[model samples]
Target: MLVTFDYFLKNLDLSNKNCLDVITQGQWLNVHPAALVFAAALAQKVGKENVIIDNTAGKSGLYIDRMGLYDWSKTESPYHYSRHEEAGRFVPVKQILTSNDQSKFITDLIPLLHLPPEKSQVIYYIMGELIRNVLEHSMSKDGAFVAAQYRPKSNVLSFGVCDTGVGLKKSLSYYHFPKDDVEALKLALMPGISGTSMSQSGTGDNAGAGLYIVKNLSKMTRNYFVIYSGTAMYKLLKYDKRIERPKIHSDPLDDRHSLVDKLPDFHGTLVGVDIALDDTSDFNALMEDIKVSYSKALRERKERRYKKVKFI
Candidate 1:
């Protein structure tokens, strides 16, 4: 199930100390989901919350040859186009990361969003997994997406991930099931569903584990998590395990009706996760980490280059 950015954030109770602190002030960021789980565990440990405002568009077909690398974002739109609107602010950063260095590119940006030890770790995993998939399978070196990190004065967090890829259409066009936006999305979200028919080797995914794990985590952690692929968007609401009885399956989310909506018959994918941090002050520290990490990495490279220069 996927959700929009605002709907995801609206469910949080931002008054808690931990939730308030994470979004307090002077913090902004953009990140992916693997890291999100890490963030959630800590937020859970600290009893904080977060939010997300996703606005990622379709796939970027990055092809490299004699012409060097092409920026997929610079190309024309798909043969058929579909655009959906969601909410929130836009923070300035690279809207696209498609290179041998994209994983590091994501690593460089992860710290900018203020997340505690656990949230940070979860996001690290989410971002790593997504970027790894993109690099290995998306067949494109460059794709585009945008997100804004909002740390409320309370220190809560909200971020989004947007991308234009093969989406569900291309992912499952060869299958025997429906192929339009709605059906495609519905099928894709199903656990263990993979667009590809012929399979071989490696990771145990293709069964909706990635999406399901994150969604379940969202409920368990009381954070906002949404996914929009083509026209089907599933939003897992922020649940209060403390107040609300524990839920084990997808049948009881507040937004379950959304799952039944006719798929959007669109293309591409956008995912967003948001949580409330207890302190906003750490937001600054988080950004500092991004800068320091990048600077230190750059310095290391410069040193390496300098040594080679001397040897040469």
Candidate 2:
């Protein structure tokens, strides 16, 4: 059995399907961070008893147990779990954020991820921005689901936020409409693209900078960043050298900066970031550089548009 969005959608008969068995001993399963969120959502909907995990050896098993995906009711006190210096360990799954208490959530997560003050601040900003996006835009009545894992040996931290609402294509169609899923994914990463008209002319509560800032941070840190929604997946992989103005595509076709198409057609959006821990780099400086670069680009674009206008 393969555990993927396609697998779940194809198998509508939850009664006959043993979801846990597939999770524990499946022949193949996508180990993407968001995949766990999808699994947890599935378990909750299909009844946890229908899914039974007899094994907990690999990353898949570890994630399933850590997130309380099998039986959320059995989750231990404090509702947050962490294993220090261990790869694949994460803060407990945050199933819903009914209130505006993101600060507390980030404060609690910092120590568990073992991030220094500087890096912690960056992560805090990223999390806060993304969570705000979910609350304001996802349109999912179920709210957002979030999880993060740190791999000490690899010096990588991965986190993802998911929702089961209208996908990016539909969301952004309200402004700067995209032709398809791939185009929607690309537009979302642009500095000024947003679902809200209030974001127009950079005068609203949102400047459409969340994903833009996140992508730049990923590039500067030489990390991995990806957004999967509808039938497309856009990604940026960490490399030794710096990359400026990474490409966005309808189909990147196995490139390092990939834009893949024809995915399982997720109803909502999943944004994941994998940051490489580097104590030597100055986090504040990197952020400043991103801001300056973005400002320059925006100004240049405005000048070009101004020049093109026929001011009769």
Candidate 3:
């Protein structure tokens, strides 16, 4: 029988160790940006001196090298190629440790993709939120590892961001008590739910809508967005394009998604998103829609809370 994505996720192990050992299947192998960043984040945790790759036996291995994963590990690249030639093709594995580095990386990223202002806006919105979450919340000293790849054939842009720090359950422990990683993920994706503060309207700086907005944006564009942390993974399945306007759900479980638990425990967080450029909507208009939706969701949630009161 064929296995689901959850099956693989359940099998993925990233335990704390003094060294990192990477082994990939031979023959055909497809590597997603999420996996790449996850591996990079693990390597950063163990130090490059303790990282090793057991095999580099096929075109897949060469692609890994091209993605600059070798630089993160102690393994030497078996193939030699000009680094300049790889430019503009993809954002290789990059480590961003501070806000300044994040800003500079975003600025330099646009030209390489050669995207027009409108298209680049989506990238900026997605990336800005993804990186900022790691910087402010993850509490990982190593920070975030991010990467991107644009496939010309499909016209889809893929992004991955990962951090080796306290996962969602721990992050939400301050104000919310989630039974497990999956429950924490649900709260994390809800608008106005932030670990930084107990207020629904997050501290002046954070509205707690980063992940919610990004996932909703992916749904609006009929794309895929995945968030994995603490042995649980929640995937926003691609929306049906046939629907003229898909209803936005305040509760993530109401949307088309897959939630699986009991996976190998990962100490941090990992996110993977794919955006179809052709389906991307106007950035400003989309943001406005998200704002309205967020407000409605928050209002409804509050109403539900009020209804639970005993008004005798």
Candidate 4:
């Protein structure tokens, strides 16, 4: 189960001076995009030569190879498949270090999924915001590492973006002090709150709405959006499908979600999202809804500030 895997991830010891041993058990392996991107980010952090895939262990070894983990690490995959045969299925692991590279990835991503413009719009929005965040704020020389898979049977797309750089608490510390990792995540998700600025509204260059928009998009679509950095992780759980109209909260904690602190520390940030294509709405319409929610959240936040203010 993914929850068990999450617990297992907490036990990973990332301090080895020589090598990283990715040990797996059982006959089958269900590798999540989050795990794949994290491993790739770690490989870059520790140097590819110092990494080892101890035992891929089953038929699923081929799946991992196809997803391009082996290509990112020192391991040479034993299984092989024709590149021409993989069209519109998945994107191999890709590293982006610049704005140009980020733009190019977004351009090349749509055709790989073979999704219509309407269906692929959210993906473009998500990737653009995520990669831009890494390039602008992560302070990672290696930039962002991304990978995704389109599951045809379930009509779902899963993707992960990772960066090995200053984590949330440290990044936000430039302008706002978050006492811990989880609190940093909370501020990161709050609309108009930015690490780059202390104002109620962010600076001209950044509105700080990227993460907030992405999280609400996932909720409005009834899917999951997860953020992990340092020793904390915040997951926006799936909304109840029975609810005809789900509320989008500016405060991430108000939504149906899960959070964990005190996990093994990851130096950078990791984000994983699952999108159900069947539930996706028109891109423009969705953005409009988010705009309304964002404005309201900011207004309410300002109102609260005055309520607590002491008149001289």
Which lDDT tens digits does candidate 3 get at residues 1-312? 011346556656666578887777675444677878888999989999999876645888887888888888898878877667546758888999999999998987878777776788899889999999999999999999998888878788888899999999999989888899999999999999999888889998887899999998888878788898998899988777898656788899999998888888889999988888877757676677787898899899888888465789
lDDT of 2 by residue, 193-307 (tens): 6788634344457677788888777766767777878888777765555454343321223326766677666678877787766731577777777767677757765676785
Q: What residue runs in model 3 are displaced by over 4 Å at the alpha carbon?
A: 1-8, 307-312
Candidate 3 clashing pairs, residues 3+ apart or interchain:
none
- Candidate 2: lDDT over CA atoms? 0.65
Kindly report which residue stretches of model 1 are placed more than 4 angstroms away from their true locations once superposed. 1-93, 97-99, 114-118, 133-148, 152-155, 197-208, 241-245, 250-257, 260-265, 276-312
lDDT, candidates in the order shown: 0.42, 0.65, 0.84, 0.83
Q: How far off is model 2, as Cα RMSD?
A: 5.8
Model 2 clashing residue pairs (backbone): none
Model 4 is weakest, by summed lDDT over 10 consecutive residues, at 1-10
Residue 63 displacement (Å), model 2:
3.9
Winner by lDDT between candidate 3 and candidate 2: 3
Question: 193 in model 1: Cα distance from truth in Å?
Answer: 2.5
Query: Against the true structure, whose lDDT is highest?
Result: 3
Candidate 1 TM-score to native: 0.50
Per model, state how many residue pairs clash. 67, 0, 0, 0
TM-scores vs. true structure, each candidate: 0.50, 0.77, 0.94, 0.94
